[model samples]
Target: MSRVADVKDEARSRLRWFAVHGVVRFFAERGIKIGDPQAKLIADPVTRANPGVVYQEIRDRGKIVKGRVAYLTVDHGLIFDLLRSDDYRTVVVGGNLPKPLRAIERRTRTAALHPLAPPSLLSVEPPSHTRYRKLVSSVFTARAVNAMRDNVQQVADTLLDELVAAGGGTVDIVSSYCAKLPVAVIGDILGVPEADRDKVLEFGELAAPSLDVGLTWSQFREVEQGLEGFDGWLATHIAGLRDNPGDDLMSQLIAASEDGVYLNDRELRATAGLVLAAGFETTVNLLGSGINLLMNNPDQLARLQDDPSLWGTAVDEMLRLESPVQMTARVAKGSVTLEGMDLEAGDLVVCVLAAGNRDPQVFDDADTFDVGRSNANKHLSFSGGRHYCLGAALARAESEVGLRTLFDRFPHLSSAGTGIKRDTRVLHGFRTLPVALGEPATVSA
Candidate 1:
């Protein structure tokens, strides 16, 4: 009887996965065939790889262009306003979906917690979001991030040292340096054991595509499995932290209380898991993209070498050129008119943040990479308003220190081969950055 029940459960799980993701994929592919910009942007890999063209196409259409599925916007000012507007919400609810799809989604909902699902910071509204954000905001503040600079520097130096010891002919910098630096720092903050850090990275990589709109069965399966493993591991880790806590951020979170009401077990897992995964994923992309940008623009690299003070602005420039997070979505709370376009309740608006970062109206010479661009900081790479990236300071610090230390150590570092971009749509970054780590600079006597 137990064996039969196990088989029945597996069948139901597969059916739910199909109903939730496969159905969406089927329609998205049809939309792509018809040249729907929004559909292509979401479902087509080629379009995702070269999204600048589509971003411009949407911009040319209008500030608020209606798509077959959702409305699209690439205007910096408009996107900025919408993100901060109370008229919009993060998660898509019943109002946005067809009756059939909504019923399927409701039935398919499982116990698994998704980063983009409710209870996660990315999906909650004001009150819950306010409470969750407050709990973790202090640790990521400018002052707190500044305190972690020394530790970041130490991690960068150690990684470079290992590269030198390897005799330095060629190495995939993404795996060796760019990815490791931020992960080490975040791991220390989150109390993840060093031996298990690689597992965390694996789970994060597999689950990353969950942020996208549609997925194939295989992709959806991999993502669900990854989330399951992470959920189990996190539950155990939290239990251990409760038994014997440390000074890490995870420990602090465990001890934290709001109005004498601590977070419940499910809420704790959701919050902690988000911190652990988000802590390093985007920073890894920032570092990888920063390195690639500097390598491509030797003139800009020379400027950084001449004046080290420019590293800060240089990091901002990199963000402007290649934002780690490319886009986000919001749902209309009720009937509203924006830029003369009427949006009903539950309408979805896709904000191409990468395009907004490069809006000519807001940025001069937007396509060109300029390290000293005065208004580089104005870019919406970290997003805006209440949902802005909590770890912006840490990502910036890591990118600046990581890039400066790398170039300073290996002044002649050059690409060994063409870098491979990540196979993700929402998160833009390199999967493998192969580089020849030239001889290190000798210290003065």
Candidate 2:
């Protein structure tokens, strides 16, 4: 059997184990308890013989319940009736976002700090947290984002120009394009220095697999040191902006603070950091998964090429199917009831956005990719309620521009046989994807 088949076989077997065990009832069976936060997970199994599986552990009532976040190659969703169970309570959403965002929540819970990081950004107070989101929405208005079309086009065009000049023989599209373009655009918007762009992108990949499951103290310390470096870098950048104003978002935010109608220095830095992470990293996964999807389904690719506007709408569908932000965490401030489980305050919950995006009941043909479908936005890829992504428009704009330019230039583009599967540590994406440039076109570099 092929290697891909082996991976698929393993996944199928794991899923089968969950089928007989019952989705929500497998955590205790797996022997995971207070050593970690308490939550229930319905995950993708290694085989089809079983349908549900226990992959994540729960320790306390404060944690949230996000069953399983799936991959595009997987069945795409896992569901459980936690709400209908006798045990239901509010718990922390124990994904990477909460832990990271919790460290500093002034202005960044809405932004992605790392592409693979998930332990931060949990909201203890949904109402206030939702309101905080509204304030950001006011800034990332449709008008503000629509204004970025020229910006997106500039970044996309410049990068492709460089790509074409490098002689277009065989390029690692992710390294050459997908991974860098969004970061370039967002970093510039936030005024991040040119010298640091590559390193920042690398940091986003550090936690692709989620928090250290069995890290020694030293390993965890290394991770913290890495985060400290990132934070320190941002602090210096903000200080520079404070000293000399520019036309970038950082300067604009500084001016807003002077007007007494905006974020403070700390808040400004957090917001800027959020913008960098959101604008670049999540889209990395989107573009990677998207290209793979297209290559896997040429029919879909042809359909998209026949109508480029479909790229905009299709982007949403892609986000749903292969959600880049995979999971988000939320912590409960006080004790609450859910799924009949009596829970206490400070419980952790890891809401699997990717899994929810593929819920069978929520989508028609949930496992299949159908860009023509009208229900794409129903996906929790951007999540729902208060914490919707502030950069959703910007992310879409980056993709629309990038994909459109790509198809326009290299309609015959295709992947090389294999790639560097983006290290599966913090994020699930491609760090390298070699593709054929195929037959130069009349397109201008």
Model 2 local distance difference test score: 0.58
- Give the TM-scores of the predictions, in the order they appear: 0.96, 0.72
- Weakest 10 consecutive residues, lDDT, candidate 2? 70-79
Q: Residue by residue across 326-398, what tens digits does model 1's lDDT show?
A: 9988999999998999898988998888999999999998999888999999888887778898888888898
Error of 1 at 167 (Å): 0.9
After superposing candidate 1 on the true structure, give the runs of residues whose Cα lies further than 4 Å from its correct spot.
1-6, 92-95, 443-445
Model 2 TM-score, 2 decimals: 0.72
Clash-forming residue pairs, model 1: none
